[model samples]
Target: MSVGTIVAVCVGNGGVPKHPVAEAKVGPDGLEGDRHRYHLHGGRDRALCLLSVDEVRSLEADGVRVAGPGAFGENLLIDGLDFSALRAGDRLLVRADDTPIELELFDVREPCATLRRIDRRFPDLMLGRSGFMARVLGEGTLRAELAIERP
Candidate 1:
């Protein structure tokens, strides 16, 4: 079985030092409501960000917060699993607490120069195909301890 983990989640318009707090929400056309959604390969108007679980683990160990560069806002940062395996329409069975919540992999979340700007090491970290985007099948608080184990 492929194992995955939830790195972190942020809600707000362009998660910066000061911004109105909000929850990560998904809607049609891949718009994250008032948030921006992007693709891992090359797409626009979607609120998605992808990073390997290994990278997330490293960040957590260092006690660092993965914030967007100035204005770009991302919701969830995941780690550990092979992102390329997740294709559009693939359903991710994420275990949320006692309940098994589902998120549909809707698109490929490619990287951008802004990502490099946010984390100077991002260019090295997300060297290959790093992450992708998905739509929430169920609404809930995507906490840090939560796991994205593939079933």
Candidate 2:
């Protein structure tokens, strides 16, 4: 079964240096108050970005200094899911108080030059591991440690 737990939730106003937040509202337009470069990020199909904690650990082990959560520009940092197993059209359900927030994975995120600025090796280290993008199918409050399951 595909399952994971949100280790962290991050957001940024419009650029790099996305910081972690305790909770946030996720909607069709994406996380509340979150913004993107527009030219290469943030659209319906690319509403939310996710990266696995495992991926971060791997990068750290490789000596790439990722600042912290949101370092890769992911809105959600999850643990225990094999990101490689996910493909376009895969659905993820995040258990919330009233109802689950559903997300549809659609594409792999490409590392941008901003990453290189963080660490000259970041771009290459995240070549195929940057993360994946998704669209919000259902809106709900998202928090860290929420259980994520594939249905």
Candidate 3:
């Protein structure tokens, strides 16, 4: 099983660059209070957005300056698990409070125009390294620094 930890939990009202949070309630439609600017974003099959820590560092190395977690519009920034190599239907079990949140990878998260706000090259740079879009198979509360298992 692939193991990792959720280094950052992020949420936003309605746009790119989500802000980190201490904890968040995750449901079928993703983090409560998190808003997607477009309908193409949030749905049963595309509820949550996930990014890898290394991907952020890689972007930085390539000259794409990132503000922080959620800068790519990701809802969860995991430190070890890289979903890019995982296929659709792969699952990640987030060890939350009392219940674990199970998420299924479904698709690559598409970048929106808002990403240009970070940098003109930011949007294109995020192409394959952007992250994955996942749906909550099991819901629960998630906080920063929690363990995540890809099983």
- What is the Å distance of residue 132 in model 2 from its true position? 0.4
- Predict model 2's lDDT versus the native: 0.87
TM-score of each predicted structure versus truth? 0.58, 0.95, 0.94
Residue 116 displacement (Å), model 2: 0.7
Across residues 24-115, which tens digit of lDDT does each residue of candidate 2 receive? Answer: 99999899989987656898999999999988988888887878898878899999988889888999999988799999998988877777
lDDT of 1 by residue, 3-122 (tens): 677655555433322122233333323324343332332233243444465544455455445543212244555666666566777777666766666676766655456555556665
Ranking by lDDT: 2, 3, 1
lDDT of 3 by residue, 1-151 (tens): 8899998889998787799998888899889879987888888898888889998898888888778888888898989885656887888898887888889999877777788888887578778788889999887888888999887
CA lDDT scores, all candidates in order: 0.51, 0.87, 0.85
Predicted model with the maximum TM-score: 2
Kindly give the stretch of ten consecutive residues in candidate 3 with the minimal lDDT sum. 80-89
- Model 2 spans with C-alpha error above 4 angstroms: none
Question: Which candidate number maximizes lDDT?
Answer: 2
Clash pairs of candidate 2? Answer: none
| Ranked candidates (TM-score, high to low) | 2, 3, 1
